[model samples]
Target: MNRPTTLALTFLTLTLAACGRPASTPAVSTDDTSSGSVADAGGHGAGGNGAAGHGDHALAAPGPDRSRLPSRAVLGPATVAPGLRVQTLPANVQPNLLALKVLILSSGPSDYGIGTARALLDQSGIPYDVLDASRTPLDTAALIAPDGSGRYQGVILTDSALIMDAGNGTYPSALDSAEWDTLFEYERTFRVRQLALYGAPGSVPEDYGLRYVAGAETATTSLRLNAAGQAVFSDLKGAAIPVTYSYTYPSALQSVPGVSTQVLATDPSGRVLAATSTSADGRERLILTSAQNPYLTHSQLLGRGLAQWLTRGVHLGEHRRFLQVDIDDVFLEGDHLTSALTLTAPFRLSGSDLLNVRTQQDRLRSNYPAAPNFRYALMFNGGGANTAVPTLCTNSPWLTRDLLSSVARCLNTQFDWVNHTLDHQRMDVMPLSTATTQIQQNLSVGTKLGLNMSRASLVTGEHSGLGFMDPTDDGTRNDDGTAGPKQDLGLGRSNPNLLSAAVSSGVTYLASDHSVASQWDAQCPTCGVPHPLNPGVFLVPRWPNSVAYHVTTPDEATAFYNSLYGPGGLFPYWDRNLTYAEFLDRESDQALTHILNGTPFPHFMHQPNLRQYAGGKSLATDWVQAALVKYSTYSKLPLNTLRWDDLGAQVRRHTAEVKASAAGTLSGTWNRSAGTVRLTSSAGTVPVTLSGASSGTLYGTDRAARYDLSGSLDVPVTPR
Candidate 1:
């Protein structure tokens, strides 16, 4: 791939009004709550910064025809060479233009722009349009008067030439002398929100009140959040984040005579690292530090927060966060029955063991209300050896088949169970036929054992860690008669056969992780544009730190769990070692971060956690109970413990809602009088989460109901 010419464009001179009268150095407040005040501008009955004419009433319908625009063109096949294959985005679904729309102006495929922005927007289910300036420089006239009127509510500029890509080496003179004069006038007169990265002086209208000033070449600098930034970025409310900056440009925004300005972050030397300014006409502009790339977690967080701020946090839905818990490797496996300092033979699962796990689950229930404490999701894999003929072991009065059936009966309840494949074989390494055996045999074994296997969501053994599909051999063999020329399948690149097999077998959910591959993969956590390959199937990445600890003794389990703490542990800042009491604190602190951020909490563990430890003590039970306490304590909102299958289904519906919202097929009106928010969509189902309502069902374009917050009734509307 070709590299971008520059990190970002220096500037794109625009002439809204001549250099504004110099204003005083605005008092920079250090309180994070300042951004909250700005957010209140979107509250009931405010039209300045809020979408024009949208007051407290939820339906801020722009006075325009509701006809859907032409869908985006479908991308051709995998024509790009191996590696760095960009998946073609699905054609844009025609949507209601009344929903807020954003346009991304870039300098072509090589421009390292909007990758992070797109990830953030897609994650929130917001729709945006892309304008490749390299193919065709921005049409300044149509930008301001597309169809003879302002067509976009917001704009993001990553390249300076987007305003005026004058082909010759000649530079545009003053702002008034440039062709962007009309662009600036429309921004001021119509109040279009914008987020610009690394632009030159006069690149944006002067009245907008933010200019990029290149910093003195220096080493990486740590950024301290000012009060305004605290309000915008939840993670930085009480913390300082560092972004390595050497050749990057820092920003300097001053409050114009009539505009309101807030400095969000400052370098050690107090140079503006980030800032936001709201114009007198309610046009808001947010500027951030220009650096190498914005794909890092910290960068993604900042960019995601910026998108939320730009949209006033209402494009997707009310700004609410959620948590989900998942448990993997659930099966009737052999375990040692110890007594009087002696070990017995292997056994499936004793009645005492089932009772112990149930007791632990009861402990989890004690922490929350009755219903929310039910069984979480379980990923099951029927042992291959025992599926055909039960293995004999002793658990006092329980052995092989009897013990397995008893355990299965204990777990038969309202729970979410997933197929983990037969004998835990990696499905990706197998062909379609082999993959079918692995999946079907497991379900078959589950049926014989009376285990709940109705759900067909496949977690895949080791999450397909064993490569996605066998390598195409060049008909060559190694010295040991092994095949040569093994190829690894990339998750982001095309894998049509795998997709075909999954859909053919009735699998609706697949596994993905939040790492590099996902950044571009069709089903990814950090993907630039997350989309499901199959219509009903959705790839849900496991929570980043979901751990699978292996240990045979109490001391080993303790040491293993503690090992995940400091240094290479999930949370390095937590230095406390694993003690019965101290482990709770350390794990709670770690889990608290996910909860406080409103991120989904899918804590994963294996089936062994339910078995007995030293002295017949159930360590898994204790560990799970402790985790439940911590997760429930800091999760902020009311707890809703869903099975993985239910959660995955909700996520699938939510993803559809997000895609349709971006396509402009969804819209809603907030009725303050009835204290309910109502939404309408072109599709039959729209999965929605009302602000404070714990549970309620919303479906289709005409469904209406008063959103109730007095009870826990805010569950998502599942499609019939």
Candidate 2:
């Protein structure tokens, strides 16, 4: 029943020799008319018929449901041919060390469940090895090392039975009887847990106490966790997890002798979707009857729980949400629009505006418990600031220069500040002396203004000097804003003058635009790439939002947005124009994805967005509030708001860990009895993240400690 549709249909066409069932109808339908949509909002369609829409207009019909399902017929136990033998475990055989790694057993590369499992491990920085059962042989040697040490701490199966078509209308186990026995024996001997990503009820290799009730559930269904589920998935605080557009099998747990089964998740009908079965032999397994892919929201929500349960809350890697916003062009006047929707004079932040931003930040921290640490990072061009103004408490409608400068000086430590060059000059083609002066003069101005700024971080005007666009073009051209032809000559062609100037100016982390594909690190997704021309400098990328840098009010921003992404516009995406609220919904949805993915890249905007356009409302605050509200809906974990220097250090450590993993130099062993984890690396420093562990920086519920593992290091663990 767990085989593919074509194989299941073929099997149904033939009469079963064991059961005298008629072969007149197919076990599973191959019709692809299932309504489902993949959107950021709940990962399902907004309309009633599973169609997505913006504002009031309905989108086109959704495509077929891509989720795979099991056959309807009840399957029987696998037939072990003559001469096949089941191996017995040796008595009193104990292994010294089991490496802190997971092993994924899959039918082949095309298995959908593999991607879902890999996505969770990859984002969390956990190391794993995948073995294709259809191609590679699984034996005791693969599971055990020569020193009698177990190879993996956890075992994950892509499917419960590993059933696949064996030509001529026959579906059989890919592992065979002897291979299944070997895997089970190792699990029993080492006391390791196994997890099945997708399962169908009935005994092939073993029974999970699940009896099939229904299949092919394509509608969006809400699943509630029971007491056991709450213990397994302690991080998820939401009441219900929505499973959308998935081929889920609702089953009932049948009582079996010498086996205890606990229901984890159940649908509205009270049928089980996920459950754990502990056999009499001390082997435990968790099986989920729903199919999942990496893109599905249900998978993203449940993947971490599966990994944590399998590893007994001890694994190398950590996942924490972060939301850091960087307001660029601080202390500078930004161009804005008038009430008539026309370009007006540039505006600087008044005392009222700065106070409003502070009030909004305080409100956000108080309102959303998950984002209590939220704070903005100011990327300042100090040349526009008036340093002569004394720090004082001024009344409303004070002198424009005095109001802004005094308030900024008074609240100097409220926000994280970084140098954005002195006069906002583009450094792509600037001379070496000019670049050095721009970098040094800004530090001087920031110090004079009494702002606590970091000398190691730098954001050049327009992310210039990164060699993203044409190197020959002068700074006057605006290529990224307009749809003009530009060539990215790679980071190798980057301005050596700017790199040298940055190195000399004590800049270690130079900001780059994430929109430029070449600017980000290819090896590590959330890490900063080292500059090709200069090894001392690293390029940390920033995410740009849809909100225009100049627009202040919602109406002005909406007009500017529709002009670019509306119907028959320059870069049209939606069929019709969208209001400001709808635009925020779309933008916040994208932001939520990055936050959930654990990316530490700061989102960048400009100064005009801080202006108080309406009663207690500004474009920047509105955007942040919307994203925070969306985040509160799904998770209760605290969002980490790291400073620019801390973020760069984190990225550097992540890059080292990635390199160490690729080289296979990092190794860890968790001692269950002693409740400690020993980590060692043959090379440089690497980050070791352990759940329920002490002696590290506390992020959310987990702790991550960095170790220069040129030697073996042991850390105490609680083993949650």
Candidate 3:
């Protein structure tokens, strides 16, 4: 294929922009061109600079005084019923094997740390049983099996001491002296590690070799990870992580014989925020003095490490950050908004625009090490491509379509390609023959263009044909000449002809809109919803963003955004019209939540969003890059990108595992000495993730492997 000089010039411009060159002026007039730097976007740099050291003397300089700030709710005094005393257990009670499960001890359901602890375990897919100390009585049976095998490998306490308010002006220990001794005895016998989600330093129920130095400090505090913390949380790259909206207790380590205290995290004053203590009897415990919730940045950053430490780097389920963007209507023309805020039809991406996108993709991967595997998935319409034109670049100005087709063919392997039908027609009411042709003809066209496309995946136009629209249309259309007010009629009303056509065309994964309630699998939030009409095809939901399909420039996007969300507009949520930068900030924040939560849903945008607005940036890439930059501030975990087929299979496996877990049919045991994990399921195949094991992806310092088990299976592992 002949290389166009325009393509080469566009690449040069993009390369210059990527290398910190000054951005070119926008082709269209914009209301605001002040795209703020990533550092100034949010509180991302709150802990960028802080003292990094080890040992008790590793103190940070005192931060700004916030003594006048109101203190957060503090733990009431810990007291047991009068005359309660510790009880001793038999020395011969020892366990040889333990199950790879966790036991969470919480004061009650209202305990804040309960949610925080559960979030960590849930996201990592680790199995855990919770017992309310205030309600449930602890016994040796709960700790050990009949065969002398321990039931849990680790224990998580809502706080250092399970103290509860007795509603009579006294805060009492939910687990009295005897109960506490029972738990400690189990830990001493089984050698299982324990983690306290929150703690107040003192010798109330137990001493962690810490003395309280200060009460709750409610402010954003920068915490530096000490040597012990770095070893436990190996993924953290020795940077200070900000802890916000937390009730913190800064403490000092006290000298205790036969007990070694290692400070994990410390505040500016060198006071402890998190620490680990090992007793003479080999019982180990990790305690964090700060309160945590799932939404906090500190919690998200520390959760995986905490879970790994709790389970000794062996657990069920997997935690992976996924971010995939699917651009729909790739070869087709979409509507565009003019500088005058008028909507116009027939706006297609030029060959130069494609080259700029390719350059930006490479730049993003190079710039953000965490997102090195990122690539865009293009959903294309075959009817819009001009295959009849010569593959070589031509001088004819009217052959823009030919130029686009030629460029796409040349760079076909750079991106993932998916079928978006032939004419981009809605299949809600299409006949079987028409639907089949729309599905198969597109595959043929993709094959003809040498595109690396898959027949197992398909993205129907507007995510139609999956039965989520108004049943009674009244034969009316909207201003855009499309059906109005689509209501979710549920998957039962899905078009049979379309389903059959897709099945015959070998389509296994069908794209659906996540905004539609009926399109997603409610049982397993991260799994693909199996179509009720056709079991062969699964509905893989795609997240939608704020970028409109019709806007090609920032000015147009800003104008359209203001009309819907600005003051005196349709939604009127914002006080004033947001600039393009502010708009991106809000949009990226939503995406960041999904990225942090390990959600694998791919976000969908339109072809117009691929336009290189300015500075070699497009609306689609900007949103993604913004989220990635923010994520980099807190985590170093790689963001996973999967093809459509692989994503579908992952969803299916995850669904099976969830079902098996819920049914209590999945179980596993880890033999420490043998360095092997044996997993078994009474029912169908279930996916089990084991850290420090052989096989699967390498996450952080441990290699987490997933095993699909139907019967019993043994996997060799290196215990951490």
Candidate 4:
């Protein structure tokens, strides 16, 4: 006889795999002493002559003129820097119709100017058009609208020489008098905004009224923000942001009369590092010390803040919350496997097993009666029951004929099929060819079985094969709960070959094993929101939970504890005998920590979770249900079960919206009318919570049974 579901839950040890290697040394170039030239950097036209009318000699050179320049206030000759002077811009109601488009001015290929600019903008999901000012010069036709209406609302100058001649910088070519006049005239007339990351000496012309004096080269600098600066630097408000510039330069501003200028940040010596200015035409201009890379948090935040400022609290679309729950180690059940091994191995759960699992899943649906579907991502390993043909069972009884196919048909149609690898091998240990082949082979097998396994999500076998996060404890087990000697598996470094193989196999969202490093952040490669980590690949992580590797009876549990926690054992302080109740308590605590973060909940489980043991005889279903119950009761927000791919897509869109929206802006508007709750957002997708509508029919802009923000911006929820 089996115990009731309530009492069947038990604690499991953390599941971990170990591989050891020396830590890798990051490559540091001693040769990058100076910024690359625009010509050498590969800007579109560093060496070529620009379009016919925008040539260098198109107009005669003009003498320097400062009569119309903004008033200059030089207070930096003193010891201590004055309070930050920043002019915050008012919210612009004139919506940017071309919110996705931006103008990128680069002089050379991957030059620090354009290269750094591209990296910053890549994660914002905003598209851009590049005009290599070096090769093709800027003329009145390109800078000003034919009908006097500006063609571009904003411009990012990677190469400073675009507006003025920075002889010592990347592009040495100076713009003609006509070009310079055209550029300044368009900005002042059209109110087009601009962000200048860096400039060579004399690069900032008097027309802009900025005196930039290049400082000594340094690797790092501390940047302090002021009150006015906080409003524009919303992401870094109330906090000092440290910036890393390959070559740090100290600069000062010559305040122009009648123009509002504010200092956003100051350097260590009390010099202005970042500042914003407002033109007479109400246009905004931002200048930074140097071009920053996206790898740094401050840099990413700066890029996002700039986008929101330029767009004035608008994004690609609305916002939507995504939840992706993955069930790992799905395989045919086998006989004689240890309870612990079973959790990680296979079991021949007959077709009836599928039905019973479905029955328990239905129970979960009952709680959210209004939700149209409950789905799971089955992360499968392909080595189980390897047959010449795609057969599930090859025994005399043939308990599971065409097992995977039948199982697929029985599962909820919305469930996702993820590739867990062909033989469940640690991808990091295998050769690139083998790793690539394993993923491809598994995908092929699933397709042959009509499983329609997608290549989007890869849950690398055994503690994330390409190790991004390794357990903090030593690899050995002890008698007490205390750990053994600390172990280090050179997992800190990313494997380029393995990543390339994963990308080739069509993996976009790769799962990571979460750590307690941060309250909410887990250890996933380039985790958090989607950025340009590996082009299209987005790394996602699962909260860490203790794993069970063996079946445990009260006596076995005692033995298990004594073996690992007893005196001189791996861990010596733990209780000699661990109870099932204690296990559940610990698991609950771990799950709660993550749930409170209120982001996506991607609880992971393995095959043995469905074993007849591990409490409740349906360990997998029991664990999942337990999680759902906790999430439903404790989370402040509503929850939706989405496939892994869909969840990735949602994150990508949400990141864009959050970057584009102003601080404290709500996702969208919800209007309840005629017994229907209508949802709408100017952004992309809106995650609308529908309470007391468990029995309601959710309708999106389309007629889909489920309510997904991607399908339509406006979704109507009506009672069934």
> Number of the top candidate by TM-score?
2
Q: Candidate 4 regions off by >4 Å?
A: 1-323, 332-352, 367-372, 385-414, 463-492, 516-533, 549-578, 614-617, 632-637, 656-720
Of 1 and 4, the candidate ahead on TM-score is 1
lDDT string, candidate 2, 50-93, tens digits? 21211001111112223322222222233433226666544434
The deviation in Å at residue 544 for candidate 4 is 2.6
The digit string of per-residue lDDT tens for model 3 on 378-443 reads 988888887765453333436554777877887788888899888776667677998899899999
- Candidate 1 vs candidate 3: the TM-score winner is 3
Q: Kindly indicate the candidate among 2 and 4 with the higher lDDT.
A: 2
Task: Please list the C-alpha lDDT of all candidates, in the order they appear.
Answer: 0.43, 0.69, 0.70, 0.44
Per-prediction TM-score to the true structure, in the order listed: 0.55, 0.82, 0.81, 0.43
Q: Give residue 649's lDDT in candidate 3 (0 to 100).
A: 75
> What C-alpha lDDT, on a 0 to 100 scale, does residue 102 get in candidate 2?
88
Quality of model 2 by C-alpha lDDT: 0.69
C-alpha lDDT of residue 72 in model 3? 43
Please give, for residues 1-720, the per-residue lDDT of candidate 1 as tens digits: 110011000110011011111111111112111110110111111111111110000111111110110011011111111222222211331111222456676545434444544544554445667776446533444453323334454667653333322334332221222323444444555455677653332333344455545433233566677777867764333445545421234556655677777888877778776777776666678765543233222343365466656654434343223445455555534223232212234333344565555555665667654224556566666762244334332243334445544455446563466777665544333466656776777777667655665464777654553232235422121101112211234554434445566667777766643221331233323222233454555676554321222233455444544443335543232445556566544444344433333334354545545566544355555545555565443222344555666666655555555555555556443222343334566555555433223243222111112321221222222110
- Which candidate's lDDT is highest? 3
Which regions in candidate 3 have their CA more than 4 angstroms from the true location?
1-74, 78-94, 162-174, 211-216, 256-258, 279-281, 338-342, 392-401, 427-431, 474-484, 521-523, 555-579, 582-586, 684-687, 694-697
